[model samples]
Target: MKNYRLERLSSQPIIQTADVQPFIEGYDVLGAFNPAACQFGDEILLLLRVAEAPKAEKGYIAIPIIEEQDGVPTLVVKKFKEPDGDYDPRVVTIDGKVYLTSISYLRIARSRDGVNFTIDAKPFLFPTRMDESYGVEDARITYLDGKYWITYTAVSEHGPGVGLAVTTDFVSVERVGMVLPPPNKDVALFPEKINGNYVLLHRPMVSDIGKPSVWLAESEDGIHWGNHRFLFGGRGLVDTKFEWEGGKIGAGPEPILTDEGWLVCYHGADPTHAYSLALALLDKNDPSIILDRSEAPLLTPELPWEREGFFPNVVFSNGWVRRPDGTIWVYYGAADSGVGLAKLIQE
Candidate 1:
């Protein structure tokens, strides 16, 4: 098989935080990225993960959190004095617990030409349940069985987990609850059922023994998944040396079935957490079998916007769309701050 090259769109950073407003009055929109894309009729829809944080006051760091207030979920800010322990640009360790600098929710944006977009006024999905109190992020959408199934990360004190939701018109959504428990995320469902069972790709993190790697699973109802099989491992599992995607790697968009095999685009991070996009081909019938993979990354952080922002040196994708002419449009998050587009022609 020939290697596929990513052709970036000239009009990059299709969406940015500056183009969006905060959902609440006192908060600020930090990022609008990692969108899940799909063709809806004549237009394309992007389910964006919009990150927001309350305006921090001087000498005090603040984190936005959602909590149940009289049975209604309410957004609030928890402020803390200058941390005596440790703090970073994205997180702060106050006392013994670590908190994110911002909170994320799902928002919908639509475009006619797939470049310019109109983000909705309010959040499309937010932290309603306690499990999602921290945020809901990095959504992957797959149209299967006559419905658009969304699998996203539900973040809270327990860590990131896979959450499911479905919608027919992108208007009314049905929450399908948490399908995969904590310490697992980056879930992407296959576009179709294989051998009468639903299939998906996910990343399960490891801390003690094994390394964080991609895995495959099948479900009879698309909800109760089982038959977990390790698909592949990355670079920096047990070795002391560092390489590309050695820190961790996760599944990106939903696997696209092609003449060659199931094309999968995923992100790999070095020890520094600098992310890049790579490709892999899985066996058509049994996705657990690896057919081929890219030796080098197809997409990396290079652009000014991609190399700087909330999280620097990152290019992460959770969605893409295949055009009728066989062109694949990859929508990715740039520095965890904006959205960028890249094109690829599978030859």
Candidate 2:
């Protein structure tokens, strides 16, 4: 058991699948969670990752895909016969090709009091390019250069990669295309430039040589990223007593600049793929240096909603906002089905 605890703000999920409408016809929402949070004027905006799947038929499996024709994008469904391989609620493997049972896109939910949210009927961001043929999911919003820079995962036939979009007002968004190549995600940009260079925390999926862990990168311009450095490792390389993060770890929300240093909330998983959130502090001047890190999880799967759902035993976050009172409001996806809120209060 851990010593520190995060205060659960709501007993139930703040956002669920039932609260959202599918962007495409003949589709059902599977989950509405993993929101990127920020403040716009007097309202708190949550860029929600809404996953939807086509209704099932008797003998065919339907896969949702985005195809462009005549310079226009359209959502199409492709049906396939069950093939030889493993099948799950999330994905199906047909020979060497993998298809997601559900497709995801970003939507905006606005809340004035931070609890009650009114979601936009249409998706805030959806698949438009071939690179995002599979889906676009898990966004992190950072306000910099007088605009809100949104970094998210763009999945396609190639693989999952990092993509960028920007908005001055939430009404109109401009897609900046892919910032990082395939097999990289969980990116969070610093609120401002660090030492005259843009800094971001990203995770590159590794299997053969290195473990999946957090890395630091600097860009002269936000679009071109280079000079990658290993900041920290996951379970096999940390000082934590338990194997809570023995699987992999990734950067969460934008790092909070504190008097002591940069406070970051990152998510980790065990060998079982159970996800949890923890804290890490980095040098204010040089974020590549680790100041301190939590030995135990700050938030984990405990509540029933968090322990069971579309994907069980998960409490993943990509967004958080700091209040005037110094408490941080963390908005996370519970069990990959619903959105929940928690708080980190200064002791």
Any residue pairs clashing in model 2, and if so which? none
On lDDT, the candidate that comes out on top is 2
lDDT of 2 at 82: 63
Off by over 4 Å in 1: 84-86, 236-242
Candidate 1 weakest ten by summed lDDT: 235-244
TM-score of each: 0.96, 0.96
| Regions more than 4 Å wrong, model 2 | 1-4, 70-73, 84-86, 237-240
Candidate 1 lDDT over residue span 96-135, tens digit each: 8878889999999999898889999998888888889899
* Residue lDDT tens for model 2, 1-347: 13335788999999887889887888999999999999899899999999999998867789898778787767789888865455585788766788887889999999998889999999999989999999999999999999999999999988899999999999999999999999999999999999999999999998789888899999998999999999987764555465888788999999989887888889999889899999889999999889888878898899999999999999999999987577789999999899999998666
